[model samples]
Target: MTSISASEGCEKGLAPGHFAPETAYLDTASAGLPPAEAVTAITSALTAASRGTATVGGYFEAAADARARFARLVGVAPGRVAISASAAVHTGLIAQSLPAGSEVLVADGDFASLVNPFHVRPDLRVRTVPLERLADGVRPGTALVAVSAVQSADGRLADLDRIAAAARAHGARTLVDASQSAGWLPLDAGAYDFTLVVGYKWLLAPKGTSFLVVPEDLGGLTPVFAGWVAGEDPWGSCYGQVTRLADCARRFDETPAFFSYVGARHSLALVEELGVERIGRHDVALADRFRAGLADLGRTPVPAPGSAIVAVPGLGTAAGRLAAAGVRVSSRAGGLRAAFHLYNTAADVDRLLEVIAGT
Candidate 1:
């Protein structure tokens, strides 16, 4: 069980003045609220792009700088990270690059983005289990062990360190979907072999944006669908000539939705300014608050920590009644799930607990 320390709520992040949007948003695990500074940065970038600043001067170059900024926020070298239109784009490319006749291990709780690619590939073999059991499922021939760093529905945090240790013992690589844990997970990028994360969830970036980090020593891994954008010298040909595929992170692609990049870059900057550790603590604390309040109502709640996600056993009751009463939550595994983000406060949890009791 993850325990959150309540005494650490200090005002040390992007500055409260920069955190606009007075509305209380409790669904950050789904989509985070962007900070005001990041919004301004994105808006300025978009405005300049519309005026042909990007196309006339240097297309994607500015975006590249933004990707570098994002890499810094996530604790990965800029060269090892690929900026993309969405998290799935990076994962799909990796999935397509799997070796012939390779079997992959996945946790049953993976996000749809990670599972769908395997479904489309008939040649690939996939095995799903509870996340705790995923590392044990890895075998000598297993090409990859993919699972979310944090469970999406219930905020059940995963032990990636243990999973990583298990994969290496079996000669398998690991791909972590940090979409649920990126902005909040306690570990640095160096801790995982490969990680895919999106700006929409934890970073509070706009939709249609994210990044992927592939280690410098990819161990012969190559993206089968590598495009011109992924090149190290995308335009080294000097005139309409192609450059070699980038040895670093750019290998993911060259051209992406620049507007989305701008949005994500802005969001990431806010996360960095706030300090990843601080932001993580804020959400973890809120989750603890929610669980405490819910427990007071005699509700069964999962207390595990790592991410802001928390779960309440449905207790064989319909979850709709609670949702209908101004409570924002989801029903999964015959239970109710509540996620916390910067926008959520202890009051939100208290209100949710009150509603659950009346239901």
Candidate 2:
């Protein structure tokens, strides 16, 4: 609606100088491009490690910093956050901790990271429900409800508030996979018993870094299988000495990749500086324009209100054409899944539109 276009938003955040000019990558749902600051921090940490300048104390400090930043990003105390290698690991841990014969409700077609964990748990009964009916599906038998904050394939934003409220009323714990939404939208960890995030997707961090939020009261659901690092004193616990593990969420944090934490810390800090609200605005603006352009081409995109991912029909062919033209995109839900992020611009949207129109 405004004459002032898209690329202008990039100026207020990190400049897009880090990305190659020839390509317009719109697949943040798969992985995010780390900011220059994050890359620099990772490089420095690697150099220090190679030179034998990195100390155990430094590693702990960086990990703590990343934990605190991720906690802030999700509106939780640092003690409530646990670092993990991937969302799937934390998902499996939570799924395994549920009592035997517990009933779990999950939305059908959610990314495998959210549902696969429950599948392997023969003791738990997993029900696949419609995404829109998740709230209505909460029944007396449902012990847990797992959902993605935003559907990765079609960008359908889940009504997490309604689902969480319903789960609470039904005495069910709520777990939300925020892999595609955490860094792009506002999230309240207090709203759910557990929140899983993958750093490589929307957090602009390396693949090895991920976060899981477990409120203090939920600490009773301890890790089903813990590594030596999960104890308070890794060395002492390993040497046949019984020791207390951390009372907080750190009990689930095994030996983490410290270098990935360094990069994630820097990236999270940059996101905080830029402001998540502003980033959401920038992303939605570009996505809205892209959707509008699709409409102009007689193509109706899948509805994803207030979401950054836009989907349109013939996605596979369109993605192929776009990639051949040096414009990167993804195909999902029988449509082209173009995800706009802090790094994208109006020019990128225009290029995608042009390619689609030409095809």
Candidate 3:
């Protein structure tokens, strides 16, 4: 991994007046703290909307800009991206797009949204494999593979390049859930037939801001529920004109939360300005520091493939203890999950270790 300069790392820390003086937020895997600029953008948009100063054209202009930025970040064409409400919604769409009776393989440690879509369909088959044994589970008969870029439970990184190659050899499509890795890790959406991204986690945006990437090679995806925004001539079809739907992924767009898109636009800009590679290095280094600190407390971290998240036993107890001391963390996957993001620092890790050691 490349090293981030100390000055750059410090610049990535929490913005001024963003958090309480004594608080250390370490649960970024669940929901990121929005940047101050994003908050301001959201409030400004909401104010305009309530005052009837926001126009439909202006709302969609911002949405289009957001989609373009997301496309640039993921290395895909803007037309291949569709603004979505959440990951669960896109998971179901991809599951339904596949032929009936297709085999969908998912890792046991993946988020529930990856598996539940296929589970509810009687015509489709869903199977679970251990996170460590995911590649071995793919076979010729498999029709689709769904997994997270970073396992939500333990922060184990998935080898998407390897998995995509294996799936392609077996004539299967791959749908990657990038919710856990998007803003910090490099992602090439063009490599997969489908990719789901949610903004609240690493993107440092609020809920209601998410998107799906669907390449043309995957074929037309039937909208599970076509709203007024589903066709090429969206406004024209409002009066029952019976227009054709779009050939691109935009056909699947839902009526988005305009204010959320405004905030997401600014958040994406921040990540772009910082450069995802630099943020990745900063986050991994902090995670390493946190793991080393836990080791000093005589606690061993659960082994994971990457440095995005560090899990150790007694997570529930540790979370309570840390909370009592005004430090925030999450208990997940049978351990204390301390997810590191760009906002984290060595000082935060030191504080967590001090609490854990009862010092």
Candidate 4:
């Protein structure tokens, strides 16, 4: 079996000491372990807050800094990114913007946060297609095509390039949920009309931080949830109706989560320093190692080439046993879901394999 050495697994800025020594954590698909820098930043923020030294201005600044860093990571202008508390909130904004009776195309079994808003609208026509046929399912009447860049249930990769092209041909807008792909996958937020990402899963930020990217024209989305923070000058516009909304995507912003952003700034900085391309290579290598071990044990995971997530059918019940044995993973869609990231190594994969073998 191929092995990735400790030196190869541990990037310069990301050390093994960043995580707990006893846990073989392969659950990055659920939530990432924040690096030491992020932990320190959050702790310092909390300390200041306790002493009443934490300023709202400082919090906003940290959020802005994190926003800029995220924009750079996803290859979009900062002006196009809107900060929100969750992907579902941003997805609702898009769903609200669509005209009643407009058709929305989505992949079958896509994350509920991405598909639920449209389904609940009642006035919209929501169509589900197999992920492999998502692009071909587009038609002239389709108002939007929404999908995840990587499937959360089975780690299947969506064909973004094809979907984007098809959407353009049909004059339909595109919304991509990159919550599962952002940290380890190289992405261009500019490729779609709308892109949504929740930071906790892969970007390593706290739960309340999320981002939405919209076209320069705001992609005709109405800022239904706009509040004081969405005003041209938030502090100045707090009392009355927002006399003027921000000219850019900030008009879609929710009030920033101060503490979350404090940690997010540092976490995103670490991601930038390590670089996405390098992280992608490292993550996939470990995932492939896991896949090889699974094959040796006569288990075949859902086919996801070049992906860092592996989901094995009929092994969902093993999750509890694996976790008790100190190997952390998730059970999703009646399968065992193991996600590898920058911090995972060959030893972690082997540890999971050993646990699975015993089970």
Candidate 5:
């Protein structure tokens, strides 16, 4: 392990420079380091819970606040924000909103959690569109095309604009699993040609936490209807009084993981303070530096030059040996493997390159 760090400066407060193992952290494309603030948020919530202050009342209020933070980050309305325990849960709600016979399309090899729901549902038909064959065909009955913005395996950035426009032309709804691209990309829901996309990964937010942004004027998609507090109508009514689901993205059921919400909110707050585009700019610059450093090895970049993830191909048999050393990069289906996120530094990249070169 080696010592190195990065930091952000904000008004009214100045965060100290971070220090973590440079040799150890390139693997964070696997799981990132939790922010100091997020850790504090969780501790504070647990403290409140221990003190009998984790009330149902406070939970809803915090949920609404979380909704606003997340909505602003993703460029959507608080009402459009549906607090889902997982991106798949958000997709399940979208599935229910559309017709039963809907056909959906997506990358064949995405993180499994995103694909399992459609496969399990008998009424819905799902198709795997290999990156090469993405333009193949969409039948008339195709209702939704579920895709990951940046596929987990090779880290290819999905062309959201193209896919969104295609779905619009075909009259099919688009469900982009923005899981891995959230913290890495500049995703404005308002700017999104695609109406619905949920952020999960790369955001450094907790697992099982995601935000879904649906279009503004679609007439009553479907009611997610899974929140107990939501049933009570957060505006001021009791549960039974409000039988209707939320009109915006909140239509999906959301469990009040107040602690996780606080953690995520803190992360978003940091992202906002530091600036999303700024964070992304830094990430891309780091990746380009890493890629350039690999020139001696005749390596090539991944399919798309995405921010959160980057690859150095041509490792061949050397790749397996590198993993045994506890370097922590998992393989994608294709020959390419990748590294990601802000926890990484130039030193980490050099070490990975050193491993490959030494091999």
Candidate 6:
């Protein structure tokens, strides 16, 4: 359980000046504050659009840059990554690819976007198991084992290596929703058959930007949602039927949200510059500091060792008070959930503890 001191984290690129001076934001799991660079990029894009100087090619290039950065972050080739609007969009595509009556194993109480898509398809058999038991739930009949790498309600991390191995042993594919883990956790997206990440949260990008990584063979998923962006020559295929789709995972691409991608490109650059391992150590240090403070206050948080999210039971009711005190956090599953990122500090952890102690 190594950690980076707040000062060390700042040196590594946690620019506190980019955030509001008065607020202690501990809710990255909900949405991250975009860095100054990302904000500038977004504003520039908007200005260019308003001036009628924005080109479609520029937007496409921005998206391509973002896609490659994300692939690098997750240890995959850019050709294996598909630009997406949301994790649900990719989840639905995976669901559509499943044969009728295929068994889909999912973690109970996982994020709705990851679980609902499978449930919506009545033809599929969806089974729910506890996150801890998800690996054991994989069976001979399981077509896919879908779970979040990090639980949103609580900070429970799935045993991804074990689950992936079990799925492989059972002849099933694995789909991992990394929305909660990507920026602050080191993830090898290539280990799973499908890995989906939404950039608005930990990646510190704008909404409407996400990424999906699939196996080299495309993991048997059909590009049912593909539009002009999925074409081998996107501009050329804009009007009529696509004469040829992309040979790689780009064939599954959703039309890029230009403004979001424009911002995402710069945001992901910051992440790469700082490195995920450094961010994770900084984040976990802050979370551990908070956990220790809560223990001294006679409050117990859900046990999550080495995690960047701390969920304290019975403190959900204190969220409004904390928010009023300028400490931003989230209330979920009847608890107060505070997520730490590279930007968080020891002072932020102390402020949260002081408010909770008062409440």
TM-score of each: 0.86, 0.93, 0.93, 0.96, 0.82, 0.97
lDDT for residue 294 in candidate 4, whole number 0-100? 94
For candidate 2, what is the total of clashing residue pairs? 1
Model 4 C-alpha lDDT per residue in residues 1-359, reported as the tens digit of each score: 24344347643324466655458888989998888888898999999999989889999999999999999999999999999989999999999999999999999999999999999999999999999999999998999999999999999999999999999999999999999999999999998999999999788888889999999999899999989999989999889799999999999999988889998998898888778877887888788888999999999999999898999999999999998998999999999999998778788888899999988
CA lDDT of every candidate: 0.70, 0.84, 0.81, 0.91, 0.62, 0.90
Q: Any runs in candidate 6 off by more than 4 Å, and if so which?
A: 1-7, 10-13
| Candidate 2: tens digits of C-alpha lDDT, residues 276-339 | 7777878888889898898898998888989998888666667888899989999886778999
Write down the worst ten-residue block by lDDT for model 3: 12-21
For candidate 5, give the lDDT: 0.62
lDDT (tens digit, per residue) of candidate 3 on 104-220: 999986898778988999999888988667777899899988999987777888888888988999988889999999988889899998998999989887888888999775345
lDDT of 1 by residue, 1-359 (tens): 23334434422222456565343345676677777766776688778877867562233755676678777876778878777767677777877888667788888867888777876788888888887787677778887888888887677777778888888888788888888887766547776778888878887877777778888876355656566665566555334434576777776663666666656666776666666676677777778777777768777676575557887776425446655565566676777777776556566667777776777
Please list all clashing residue pairs in model 6, or write none if there are none: none
Supply the global lDDT for candidate 4. 0.91
Off by over 4 Å in 3: 1-3, 6-22
Clashing pairs in 1: 79-249, 155-309, 229-253, 229-254, 230-253, 231-246, 232-245, 232-246
Q: Which stretches of candidate 1 lie over 4 Å from their true place?
A: 1-5, 8-15, 48-62, 235-243, 315-334
lDDT of 5 by residue, 1-359 (tens): 12222222211112234324323344445555556777787788789889987776666566677678777778777766667677666666666666677787877787676677777788888888775455445556677777777776666787777777777778766777776667767777664423333333455555556676766763345664555455535555344455665555555646656676767766666666666666665566666666776666777767567455765555545556667654556555544355545555555556667787777
Q: Cα RMSD (Å) per model?
A: 3.8, 2.8, 2.3, 2.8, 5.2, 2.0
What count of clashes does model 5 give? Answer: 5
Worst ten in a row by lDDT for model 6 = 4-13
Q: Where in model 5 is the C-alpha error above 4 Å?
A: 1-23, 191-200, 217-220, 232-242, 312-328, 334-336
